[model samples]
Target: MLPRLNLRTSFQLAYRARFGWLATGSLVALLSTALLSAQFSGRQPATVALDTGLSVLRLLLSLVLVLMTQELLSREFDRRYFLNTLSYPHPRHSLLLGRFAAVAILTLGLLLLLAVALALLAWLIGQGYAQATPVALGSQYLVTIAFIGVDLLLLTAVASLLAVVASTPSFVLLGTFGFMLVARSFGAIVELLTRNTAVVTDAENYRSGIGLLGYLLPDLGALDVRMIALYGRMELLPADWPWLLLSCLVYTVGLLAMAVWALQRKHFA
Candidate 1:
């Protein structure tokens, strides 16, 4: 475990790929500034511009996290490099955690760098920007990144689990993408089910089934409370924070356990 932690920590600091993502998201800040000028007539257009840019950055970065995670941990190992790790005395859990940690770090760093770029843009644009305070804005951005990290930890754990269990890289990639779609669309799904009666059959049973799924699936969208992070309090109510943090931790551990079990009997074709 300690070795895995060390491995994860070391890999997390290596930002080569992550920096490229940061550069990409920075482009959103540039385009968003122009968009905001046309869309926002408010006195706080600067705030609107920054938030819009951050939103775009957050979205693209999330997708980047999923793609990069699948490529880094799943695709390579699925292609057989996993044998290198298997040859060692290392525990499977360590490998799982190490993989998750590396991806989470990459995601967090990309978001942070994008946040910095957006803040700098706000500073340089001065009229509407005069109201924009970089320190406060940066803190808000950090909080959003923190929120992304919590779920990124859980999601990567699950994705790695899928990879361990899957027969091929294609299967792992498809499964991860499917899970991401479900996790992200659950809200709209529930809303659609509630509003339209034809989509689901056996109303009572359907509701019960979806309810069960809701309890099982992670509430990833809850982490996108960007406005809450940007302009409101970062502190969660004592009761709330612990439950949320625990859910993520438990989900992460559960997925890791599943991954280890699957890998135990795994054999390449």
Candidate 2:
């Protein structure tokens, strides 16, 4: 239907405009970082390489998601190119959802490519050295990558929502990253405050305030499973996976719903 066609067109446009260079640059950066980290770290080279690669991959994917949102959504609106599409008989929410779907697919595709490259690089790095704690290249690594994808999709949902509500493309990029920083850091901040009550006199009040913010924001930090991939520590993952998956799903769907509602009411002049 219209959603399918819109998805195809949006994806094709994004592929042609951004995907090629972005993918190439991202792969190069990921592999280069892994190699350098492996070279520099005498002990546990593979673990360091994998850890650095995952961090770099997360950053690169976030940049890709934000840039794609800016180009595909905000820029289209800014240049009035979206007007022609909005004039179609299809519902506004369909168009918005279709475009968001394109972003999701493209981001996931990039994540997969970079993840494969990182895994290969990690394996190659491990082959030369036998460390005390070997890197987990099997299911654990795959699970880590899957969770990272979930995190990026959540970010994409944030971008999609901001794209609809914000006035400028810059705001969409800024707002998305800002939301990410807060979501990722708030949990750690609360935990640090909880552990070191002496660090702040009003720790209880501060914890309560941050706890309030936690309810509004997705706990992105909870989704980080790099340690499991790097060290094969599965002690906490079994109990945490279901809750993490559910929280991500709920937040993503809720954000997309809000985006659709906003797009439906948008007065595109």
Best by TM-score: 2
Please, what are the lDDT tens digits per residue for candidate 2 over residues 108-210?
9989999988999888888899999999989898889899999999999999999999999999888998999898889889999999999888999999899
The sequence of per-residue lDDT tens digits that candidate 1 reaches over residues 184-243 is 677556766777868868765676666676787876665665664445455532336557
Best lDDT goes to which candidate? 2
Any residue pairs clashing in model 2, and if so which?
none
- TM-score: model 1 vs. ground truth: 0.71
Stretches of candidate 1 above 4 Å error?
Answer: 1-43, 122-141, 187-209, 230-241
In model 2, the runs with Cα more than 4 Å from the true position are: none
| TM-score of every prediction relative to native | 0.71, 0.96
Error of 2 at 62 (Å): 0.6
Error of model 2, residue 26, in angstroms: 0.7
